[model samples]
Target: MLDATTITAPIFIEDMEVGLTRHLEKIISDHDISLFAEVSEDRNPVHLNDEYAESTMFGGRIAHGMLTAALISAVIGEQLPGHGTVYLRQSMAFLAPVRPGDLVRAEVEVKSIDLRRSRVTLDTRCLVDETRVLHGEALVLAPSRG
Candidate 1:
């Protein structure tokens, strides 16, 4: 069985801080790539076919970028700003490729909060072995617990 842990507690708009953060770690697998392709209909050969990927700049198959980013989503939806949070928008830049066996750590830190608007802006990033693979920001509508 896979083990998991919460890097931070659930947060609400009333309790969020500009520096609050959370994260999770997971290993990318071939099964994950296949399932993501099926659900997203992103059947790019580079993510599925080893031969095709070998001829590309990545030199081998790589996980879908969005799939890697979903780690950020998992943290947002399940940890910080927990349940009842709704994603408003996200922007990302893929800095490196994530392979099937790569272990990735997805993290998020609150950058600002608009209490009146019930929104939180967070700095998002995914890293492997201390090297950043993805970096971005997200806007989310935090739940009102009051």
Candidate 2:
């Protein structure tokens, strides 16, 4: 159901390898949180209101888990199986809070490939200052080059 604009130059099934990996780094910001809230319509108080968030276990505002997860999407779409990779499934565990100003590094590593179906499974994780804040796996449909 993705529109034409979303697809990019595919890496193709043959071009991918089992050990392929990619990483992207970003600093969580208030603006990023606000935009994510607006776009995703997930206006949780813990992600926006500092005072309210202070009352929670997080002690202060934290970014949406999905925002950090989206970095995995960015790696899949723009790096490893660059461009035409279509995400089929993703399972993530939020291990730690991602607060604003926290520099996060998202990483994806190819775990296995189903050549017949052009499917790829990858291990995904995100770290903030060397602490693993998230971990998961992803399934994607890679585009065919030919």
Candidate 3:
């Protein structure tokens, strides 16, 4: 029996179409940096130690590139193809550093939809204000209707 405590993310891909887009914004905070560092075990000095990072090319602490890119995943999973979508592949390029407290805006736009194969191709990008910090492409298996 389905109970109140049971979690569910229903498949909603039948109506998926090309050109659809979604956006997600988040402030990447100091606490966020610390927590992501811990969870990802990416204790890189550039991403964790302000003093050490000051000597690096970025000149100070910076968030992990993947941490910024993860926002793309959030947009895809929660809003684009949306809940229950299965990720098949992703490719990204990091363009700039995201320092603490930057408001990262992530957007994903569906570039194509192959309904026969239940596949969706999306263009993804993350920006700090008008500056793009990351850009990528993602291919996902849009859930098939039974």
Candidate 4:
């Protein structure tokens, strides 16, 4: 957990100019996949059976799109515009498949800010190497000074 006291300076319009970057290297663990599968109840063979996955066009087990999208939440909750940030909406497009061993990274840039309204617009994307796996825009309510 981050120390709030360390963040002594008030977040302002100028602070929005700084974008945050993160590299997520943990391979999607089997336990994580199993939990997601049970929760979503999506027993797609490509996700569950390695033998079946080898027969598919993807040629291997692929992670769920929603699972990849969840990285966006981590970026918001743990990284930039963190803690007090409230999500207004998110629009995303999945461009490629994500296999278990592939490392996915989420990058977010503050596109616009409405200080009076306490809203911020972010351009977000998840990528594997140079190939984009998912891209989107997120609208979030920035914390207001009381």
Candidate lDDT (C-alpha), each: 0.91, 0.90, 0.85, 0.77
- What would the per-residue lDDT of candidate 1 be over residues 19-128, giving only the tens digit for each residue? 99988899999999999999999999999999999999999999999999999998898887877799999999999999999999999999999998999999999999
> Whole-model lDDT for model 1 versus the true structure?
0.91
Can you write out model 2's per-residue Cα lDDT over 1-146, one digit (the tens) per residue? Answer: 13447755657778889988888899999999999999999999999998999999889999999999998888888877878688899999999999999999999999999999989999999999989999999999987766
Which candidate comes out best when scored by TM-score? Answer: 1
Q: Considering every candidate listed, which one attains the maximal lDDT?
A: 1
Better of 1 and 3 by lDDT: 1
Per-model TM-score, in order, reads 0.91, 0.90, 0.89, 0.83
lDDT of 4: 0.77
lDDT of 3 by residue, 34-117 (tens): 999899999998988989999999999999999898889877776677667899999999999999999999999888888778
Off by over 4 Å in 2: 1-9
- Please give the ranking of all candidate structures by TM-score, highest first, separated by commas: 1, 2, 3, 4
Native-to-model Cα distance after best TM-score fit, residue 17 in candidate 3, in Å: 2.3
Instruction: Name the lDDT of candidate 3.
Output: 0.85
What clash pairs does model 1 have?
Answer: none
Q: What is the lDDT of residue 24 in candidate 2?
A: 87
Error of 4 at 141 (Å): 0.6
| Model 3 alpha-carbon drift over 4 Å, by segment | 1-11
Off by over 4 Å in 1: 1-9
Q: Let me know the TM-score candidate 3 reaches against the reference structure.
A: 0.89
